[model samples]
Target: MSGTGDTAPGADAGELPAYAERVLSVAELIPAGRVMTYGDVAEYLAEEGQPEGLPAEGGGGRRVGGPRQVGRVMALYGGAVPWWRVVRADGRLLPGSELRALAHYRDEGTPLRAASQGSDDHIPKIDMRRARWDGRQDERDAPWDD
Candidate 1:
């Protein structure tokens, strides 16, 4: 595993750990105007690999890594996917890439909440209540059944 070269998108196969690849695959599946938390992405992959009827949060008996691991994968290989579509559980934009991500969110019409009253800037934050994607369904229920 140590010797594997870059496995990010556009790179050759086998460069990424199997789990990392699966993580990225799920990242790619997230649609525009929608977002999944790192934990959500992990759970989504877990559910997809496991049989139906598993617990929604843990994916019964499966071992999907936590949000930190999912974030690591995103840090290393998420450039090719809709990285912005994967966000924190709190719905705050990625720390350093907030503006860039905000652009995408705006372009995609992702739901957002105005900055808090005491905040210095007017930068809007994602409205997780409205924008979170569970990888199960969108508002239209067009994709991802189960």
Candidate 2:
């Protein structure tokens, strides 16, 4: 693939990694009570978007094209993945027919830094800048672990 989304050299389009699979890897990695942003995962996939230690190079750099793209995958097929980890850009939840998503978040101990401060009209957001996980690089890199 010469361009960003182009088929990698000698690689068939069908051989490319599925975006949902990438989404789920991190989803599964997130501890039961933690969460992440769609853009955060997008950043991880895009390299530039991830923070210091995300495995951005994974998925052969072929994760979903963007955050919105990731969101669409989750919307359609996130039933088994950690759907709650992905929140809106502003830290709000992505909507769906299952009213239980929010309730599930509440039950899993997904951090709610906003404390429902916004409004009655919106799902309470987590303030991405504050609550975003730093990924496990720091934990794995701790001097004691080695």
Candidate 3:
């Protein structure tokens, strides 16, 4: 986990740290045209030391390590994975890499909101309501809660 940034996880006879590996694994599971927030990724992995009072099942658990740590792992060791599939909570593209990420999103047919005329930079955004993936069964497919 300490080297030139060009090397990908397991690229040079080395492996990513355990937590980072888990994070990248979850990133890989995000299907094409869908996305997960950093927090969602953390919850999906069920990392240890989750905060209290959140349920362990059904994606109600508090995420472990929070978003910044997840971002760090992605920055450090995520080049080989579909790094763009992990995104901000608000569904905005990653700063400094927006165009590159948007290219992937377009190619995958991820839903997007066309930029409004009044938008600060007129940059399109992810249509999160239609595109968010929580690593769970579709609500339509789940049995009724009752």
Candidate 4:
């Protein structure tokens, strides 16, 4: 779908792919001081059009995408949003942008764990347990349950 229309949050409708628009919208929903893994964002979007308790693959809606697509969207169009909040599942800071992401994390009070003494980069890792956000304001309103 190509059109010169406005979409959600950070992009013009035709400027980005439909899936990319949805991906960025989810990224924007992430609360400050919290984060979601790439897979989390993808899974969230995939489930958005699916029926309750149904697997994404079984849903009749168009396939949104997966972790790699999310990463690609972020890498290409994430500069204008809180790109740092979408992270690796293992909690390591994004490579190459580690210092930049760390600054934002510190500013937002995102939970972080000290890197082990022998860690390669010496940058602190995000404390995934404490910092991961489920993108739900309340359990009852959640689109899907674990």
The digit string of per-residue lDDT tens for model 2 on 15-44 reads 334565566566656655555677776766
Residue 54 lDDT, candidate 1, scale 0-100: 32
lDDT of residue 114 for candidate 2? 45
Clashing residue pairs, backbone N/CA/C < 3 A, model 2: 1-8, 1-9, 43-49, 43-50
Give the 10-residue window scoring lowest on summed lDDT in candidate 1. 1-10
Report the lDDT tens digits of candidate 3 across residue range 1-146: 12113456455567656677667777877788888898887766665443343235435343456677888888878887888888887878887777888889999999899887887977789888788886653434321122
Worst 10 residues of 4 by lDDT: 1-10
Give the TM-scores of the predictions, in the order they appear: 0.76, 0.61, 0.74, 0.76
7-92 per-residue lDDT for model 1 (tens digits):
34434554767667677777777779988888887777665454343333343435558888889888877777788888888878
- Which TM-score value belongs to model 2? 0.61
Ranking by TM-score: 4, 1, 3, 2
Better of 1 and 3 by TM-score: 1
Off by over 4 Å in 4: 1-14, 49-61, 138-146
- What lDDT is reached at residue 35 by model 3? 88
Output the worst ten-in-a-row residue range by lDDT, candidate 3.
137-146
Candidates in order have lDDT scores of 0.72, 0.55, 0.72, 0.74
